[model samples]
Target chain A: MKNPLYLLQRALTYLVLIVASLLSVFPFFWLLVGATNTSADIIKGKADIGGALIDNILTFFERVDVPLVFWNSIYIAVTATFLTLLVSSLAGYAFEIFRSQVRERIFGGMLLMLSIPFAALMIPLFTMMGRLGLINNHLAIILPGIASIFIIFYFRQATKAFPRELRDAARIDGLKEWQIFFYIYLPVMRSTYAAATIIVFMLNWNNYLWPLIVLQTNDKKTLTLVVSSLLSGYYPDFGVIMVATIFATLPILIIFFVLQRRFVEGMLGSIK
Target chain B: MLCGGERFDLARTGLARTERLNGWMFIMPALVLLGVFMIYPILWSLWMSFQVGRGMNLSFGGFANILRLTQDPVFQRALSNTFIFLIVQVPIMLVLALIFATMLNDSKLWGRSLFRTAIFLPCVTSLVAYSVLFRSLFLADGFVNDFLLGLHLISEPIPWLADPFWAKIVIIMAITWRWTGYNMIFYLAAMQNIDRSIYESAKIDGVPTWARFWYLTVPMLKPVILFTSVISTIGTLQLFDEVNNIPPNAGGPSDATLTLSLYIYNLSFRFMPSFGYAATVSYVIVILVGILSYFQFMVVRDKRR
Candidate 1:
């Protein structure tokens, strides 16, 4: 029989795990329940689902340009994700396959650049964007993010797992290098792309600081900016704000759940 | 024989030339973009830091901004607040993550995936959305106070967002909530890579459970612990979203939740645009990250020896 102390420890372990899980999940539950309640009910600390979800959503829609904001977010995120993946992957593939001393030094330098926080670059980037007449444009967001150093690092790490024989075989077939990358390398490393797609999409979709600074016009704002603006109103309707929060959150949550495994793989791939 | 050798040499050179060309072609787009966005901005910011100005009226001020920083109360507040967050929140969150990761690493643990998924769920929400949620939840009459009152844990509602001290706590709690599971995932991954036989041998030798964990598991996870701590430290130093959003005054109630990043934002845009001084404030974050990361690496390396 197991000792009493061991059994007690096991029981305590389960208890702690259960508590932590509940705490982790509680806010999400509150978000949903809060969405369904009236502003007054929420303020009164109501935890149960109420009959105000439709009202809240309608109020949120009225206060914000729902379709336009979502479109803006989706358009920027999709374009940025596609460009980042394509550009970073090509660099990653070349860095690995065409390994050279000069290129290796450049790659190392780029990695060091990763530690330079975005806060430092924002002022200059803003000025540069203003000079180029790109401020408040969606391209302003898309262009700068396309060559993400972190994603490139991730792709390079994942690329190490890519088989070399396939490349040689493609070359033997007289396929040009670009054609080999498109036809052979692309299909073979689809999982890596899928993982990267989810991560980059989430990042671009949820990007706050840069967009907050650059996108000044109401019409140009993304759903994230809209939600924050909604909260800043003097009388922030909790119910309505909850709905907006959910709308902003749902797309990435859906993507995460749908591509959950690859998302996990993508995260693990980063530190490897 | 000489003609044949020259032809072979020429063929090899031709192959090398094509390979080099292809490599440059492949990497050129990303390199050019990074050059335009990252390198240019870094150099520009460095130059801008030396030029003191308000709005567009600028003049060169070499050591002037540095002197201002030493005397600036707001800058000092932001720097100290950022360090407080880095010191307090990072270790708490990382320790919790490490503990949760070890518990979840148990093969015999039931509903392991459910717990893991739940813990990681917070990462899915956008920063703004989560901050909004937390703001409502921590309001004076919000769910947190209600729950605490119900449990008889408090005699009166605590002003979570309104008070200076509690506001900082709220930001710390919000960050810890959002990132603990993310760090936990790293630890869990590293823990899984650890061979199970090490534990089995320790158990066979009658090593106590706590001793086995303390001596064996913690030592093995040292690298990951170090890695997560450094990442968390960098993240804490750059804390902005939660503080900027959660507080009613946007890092107010006497600027208790004001971070260096938020201060930089205010300097450049919110207040009168002192772009030069703002750039200077941002450099402090860069310097802090460099020093803290170096210390973390050294501490981890020395412990290993």
Candidate 2:
């Protein structure tokens, strides 16, 4: 028979794990339940799912222009993600494949730049965007984020695993440099691209601070800004706010679940 | 034969030149964007910090903004509040993450994937979405208060957003909830790479579980722990989204949750635009990150020897 102490230890482990799992998952349940309950029932601390989800969704749609904000978010996120992956991957590949003292120093400088908070850069960036007359434009949001330092760093790390023999073979076959990159490197590193796509897309989608500052017009705002503005209203219907929150969170959640393994690997790729 | 050798040498030089050009061609786009967006803005902000300004009308006043940072009560409050968060929350979150990682690292644990997925789910939500959820959940008459009262944990409902202390508590709780699992993922990844033989050897000896954890696992995971700490430190120093969106009055109930980034936002945008002062405030975060990161590295280094 197993020792009593070992059994107790196992029980304690399960107890702690169960408690943690509950705490971690409770907020999501609260979010879904809150979406279905009216403001009164939510305030009354009702835990069970209610039947007001349709009403809440309708109210959110009525208060906000759902299609425009979603378009803004989607357009910016997709364009930004595509450009970030393409540009950063090329840079990452070049950084790894080509060795030079000057380029390595520049790469080091970029790493240091990662620590420079966005708060510090916002004032000047805003002024620059204003001068270009790009204020309230989705391009303003997409342009600056296209060369993300963190993504470049991640791609550089991932690129270390790319096979040198393939590049050599491609060169021997008379494939041009850019041609090899387009045909061989791109397809071979599709998993890295997948991981980076999810990450960059999520960042661009949920981006708040810069977008909040730049996008002045209601028609130009993204879903994040719209949901935030919903709460600032006088009797923020918890139900409606929850609906909007769910709408904002759903796409990223779907992408994350679908590409869950790559997402985790992508996160690991950075620190490695 | 000499003519043929000359031609081959020329071809080698031409190929090297083309390779160099290709390298630059590949990186030029990203470099140009970074220069315009990151490098130029960094220099401009540094220069702007020295220019005393209101709105766009400005004059260079060296040390003026820095002097204002000294006397400004709001700046001091934001600075102290940020430090308090860094000191208290970072350790709590990191320790919890380390513990959860150690526990979940066990292959024998049942439902391990479920627990891991659930814990990690919070990190996927947008900052604003989670903030709004937390705000509603922690309202004075909200579910948290109702649940606590039902459990007889407290006699009266807590004013989570309205009171200063409770508001800070709520912000800390919110941050911990969102980030602990994120840090845990890093530790978990690091833990999986550690050789299982070491733990097995320790088990064969009389070393207890806690001692094995303290002596073996913690030391092995030092680099990852240091990495997560620095990232957490930087994140806390720039804490804004939750504070900005969670409280009824962004950093409200007497600025208890006011962080440096939010203060910078307020100075530049919310109030009469003090662009110079805000730039100076932003530099405070940069400096804090530099200093704290140095100390963290130093501490880790000293422990190694």
Candidate 3:
């Protein structure tokens, strides 16, 4: 089945794929190598690994309140993820199962809102936060994001694949709607939850602009805000910055790896 | 039988009422949250856009901020820079993603999964981390410059972040690197769902590879392409993280990389808190996205007819 032309095409595909992959993955590798080199060496464009990882880590920890900031990010992300999934998924399920003309219109409106840039909403949201006395509060970060339109859309789309027969059988067996959603639907859609968890958590963790505005003090900063401000310092250390960036990136990376298969499946479910 | 039928009908009606109540219950939390967080803020911002203000001292001056927006040179710069990035970068990224996706969709391709994973990894990368990596990599004496210089591509190192023109290129490259993979995943997913038999029959008809791709794979991927383009348009217009992080100042080198989102940030936070003017700039983004997306959908629809 393989002719000369076919072979040439295959070779060309392989070459492009390889180059693209390297280009895509090289920065992460550079991040790792940069963490191991001194700031001076990094400035000199040193590519080789050095034994400066410990020093970089120490420098980073000393410069920042590592535990408090880490906890701030983790708390916000986890709480936001949990609430978003619970609220949005419930709405999604309802939108699918209990469809109505009015509800459908609401759903369309939500999609349009999703397109409205969050920047557009920032000032008023900031004002509302101020009114509620939530300035410099982590709740300010977590609350606004809980009703995520994208997650709702994803869950609604994914719910299309849920079997109607299961719901029917549960109804016949005396299961209540909420009970069926909890006992049956929730268990079945664990993979979707896993996928959404990674995404929502990542977004919350890397949330820069809103958190930057709301969380005012040094002690309240997330890793993202902290890292960004770190760059603006009088003498920014790339090695220390690398170490902090790696820390900031590590949790999401680990979550991605652990749920990689489910994440892809989750994406497939949404697009369908 | 008549009595039984009447009872069944009553029960069904009762169940319908219950379902309606349950539906409201399920959606109540989201709706309430949206009301407080999204809807209210949106309305307030809309109102704010009509007012003239600095800090908290505000007065309703209808159309003042809108008029200011017309005359604001920084807004003009940011608007033009945004369009340049949108026009230049979006197509390049989308086309590359499409090409990569098609090539990878070949079932006979070896190491397909590895390549897919590698390419897609960039999208999940932390914005701060990637921005830092890119800034360093494109430094005058950094890896990218070193490699280019070694290959004799240029006689001197390019001032990627320092220069106005090159700064825009650096931001584009950064975003393209981060998001091209995300777009490719969508295309790849869509391509897989496409009937392979179409390609097989086309091959049997002695269709050239390029023709088969152009006439076949592309038409099938239209909906997905449209969806990505609209989403990408919104994302690009809201481009902040890359520009804010890559440049020395958030929107720097004389606002070369300043975007609408960044301008809004500057007006509100950096420049004595012109919330009204900031809100005005924000609406500009909304209008642009609205228009571009409408145009994109129209184009897609026209192609179908």
* Runs in model 2 lying further than 4 Å from the true structure: B1-11, B293-305
Per-residue alpha-carbon lDDT of candidate 3 for residues B1-305, written as tens digits (9 for 90 to 100)? 24467779887888778988998899989999999888888888888898886999989999888888888898999999999999999999999999999999987778889999999999777787799898778766778888888899999988887899999999999999999998999999889899988899998999989999899999888888888888788889998888888887777788999999999999998879989889888888878877876776576678679
Q: B1-305, model 1: which lDDT tens digit per residue?
A: 24467778887787778889999999999999999999999888988899998998879999899999999999999999998998899999998998899899998889999999989989888889999988889889888999999999998999998899999899889998999889999999999899999999999999998898899999998888887888888888888878888987887889999999999999998998999999999988888887876777587678779
Task: Give the TM-scores of the predictions, in the order they appear.
Answer: 0.97, 0.96, 0.95
For model 3, the DockQ equals 0.71
Higher-lDDT candidate of 1 and 3: 1
Per-candidate alpha-carbon RMSD to the true structure: 2.4, 2.6, 2.4
For A1-272, candidate 1 gives per-residue lDDT tens digits of: 38899899999988988999899999999999999999998888899989999999888888888999999999999999999999999999899888788999999798678778889999999999999999999888999889988888887888889899999898899999999999999999999899888888988999999999999999999999988888884468999999989889998888888888888887777554
Q: What is the C-alpha DockQ of each candidate?
A: 0.79, 0.77, 0.71
In candidate 1, position A22 carries an lDDT of 94
> Which digits, one per residue and each the tens of the lDDT, describe model 3 over residues A1-272?
58999889888888999999999999999999999999877876778899999999998889899999999999999999899999999999999999878889999788667767899999999888899999999999999999988889889988999999999999999999999999999999887888877777878888888998999998999999888888763256889888988989888788778888866665555433
Model 3, chain B only, scores a TM-score of 0.94
- True-vs-predicted CA distance for residue A234, candidate 3, Å: 6.8
Q: Candidate 1: which docking quality band?
A: medium
The CAPRI-style docking tier of model 2 reads: medium
Q: What share of the true interface contacts does candidate 1 keep?
A: 0.74
Pairwise DockQ winner, candidates 2 and 3: 2
